[model samples]
Target: MKLKQLSVALFTAATLTAGSNSKADTITTPEVITKTTSAFFNCADYEVVGVCFWLYCTITGCTVKTSAKVAHYNPEITTQTYRNAEKPPWVETRVMLDAMQAGHDGSLIGIILETMGSGLDELGGGAGSENKAASHSNMTFTLTDSFGNPVLLASKVIGSSGYVCDPQLTPMYPYYVSNLDTVAWRFSIPEMFYPQSLNPFGSLLGSNSYNWGGYYPRIGHVTNHDLVKESGLIAFRSAHFLSRRGESHVYTTIAQNSREGFWPPGPLTEHSGKWQQLAPKGETSCKTFPLSAGTGPSDGLSGYRSDDGAHVWNLWRRYKCCKDRGDFLYDIEW
Candidate 1:
């Protein structure tokens, strides 16, 4: 089925099973893979942005070839944040991460991990972890990623495979883990002292301060009264950190420059990109954080907050690309 259709089908199925007594503590790999089919693919977002003209050089003469430049958002990274590193909501590697935590504790010399495994989730504030937050703070951010998404794999088998774009990052891998960077993530290092961090208008999450909160310091701890907004701010902070290139953050940049046949997305900024919730109940559609009042699901709704204080979201950014049809890209026409 088409990706858009798959979303409809999944929602229908979820509605039918809404009454089931069984519940999931954390989002599972199988569940993620299943939700990806529909969550990643959105026919409405996919569009022909422009046309690319390429020079096809031959032995005798050269000809210009044209290709359609298509633009759409790809669910590139699975960003997750939770209170505990050992019990990440992503179930596939929960036990393994727990074992690593144990090993770190038992070693005689104390083998502090320079780098953890790729499957590990972002270590949000926990009981004894570095990110532990004050009681008044509703939550802390621990941004992490399980690399590339499986939606690309699913798209290859689907009938609309031609529309799919190659992922810039590897699949099922960890590109960024907040726990590793203590100075920057915890104290916000120099970022907190920067003018932007000090200014309320700088790096604002929504249109105004009333929406969510400022994005400075890029720390995980949030004192917002609403749980849903807090989760959204944490997700936004992580995305902001990853979207740009900086030595402060231990992460790979998701921003890509436009090239000849491939036009990738640039740095993520508020209002420029959208988010799709993937855990504590997956969402079928995408929306901005601190969604406008009276919009879909808001902070007033119940159950959006995860029981374990773990939340996962897929960052969707726009990209444009065209199939290579000639020797060199000559020009682009709108």
Candidate 2:
């Protein structure tokens, strides 16, 4: 019943609902405005009646948003960050191949990671009303622990520019890599971690003190570390939650549960060749997404970029290495 593993009926209904309301959450720096009052002027505002009110709010130092302010994207979840606080549970982060984007390279598989964590058995804390709930994050954000003090993240992905968590995720969306030391990427949760709600993605994570973004994957790294310096802040971004309207964003909400290890897409098993579970790869768009650097064909797909000299092939939703043009080995006829 989880968002990722929802029944087809629920999934279709939810997707429909979400598609209608999904809009980017933009956060901008408060604009600087000079209030002015005159015979025919008011303060400009969100809801404009005339020039009178505009000048009033401006004179009161309450003018509406000003163009002088810089635009900042908050990516706020707006609501519903299901964190596990009663008992801080250790989560799992794994890498798997997205067969949906597979090709002759045996399905380009690398460290595109996803973490699974737990949530409240029920809507505990003030979850029912505007997220006034005191859940794991709100409770422990100030308290110091092994991972040191944690910061509340409204969205799963670190929006702080220039900061990258796992290279598999940022700087480049993870793609096909061969025989690499994939062991460098593993993460878990600590006893006291940040619980964020109203975040872009309803993820619970333990971030490092640097807060700017991330640390490179290192060798001999343990899956779950006891110190922030060792582990850094890890996120469970793939979890999903059921919405009150019976609709939910596919990979943003998580199930309020009593236990952990609830795979975002369901339990997956590794087979000799590929993973044996059916999970829609999170963020599985082709290489055309902005900031994408891969070895896709130059003329392949729109918005898709070719390799950055990394020798990596970029398949912009096309799985075949070469599309058949029906120009078989037949003799050429004019």
Superposed on all Cα atoms, the candidates' RMSDs to the truth, in angstroms, are: 7.9, 26.1
State the weakest 10-residue window (summed lDDT) of model 2: 31-40
Query: TM-score, each model?
Result: 0.77, 0.17
In candidate 2, position 47 carries an lDDT of: 24
CA lDDT scores, all candidates in order: 0.62, 0.17
Residue by residue across 179-266, what tens digits does model 2's lDDT show?
Answer: 1212222121221132342232332222222121221111112222122211112111111111111221112121122111110122
lDDT of 1 by residue, 173-252 (tens): 45565655545665577678888888977767777635688888687667565556677787788778677876477666
lDDT of 2 at 185: 21
Give per-candidate clash totals.
Answer: 1, 26
Off by more than 4 A, model 2: 1-14, 17-66, 71-73, 76-97, 100-214, 218-232, 235-334
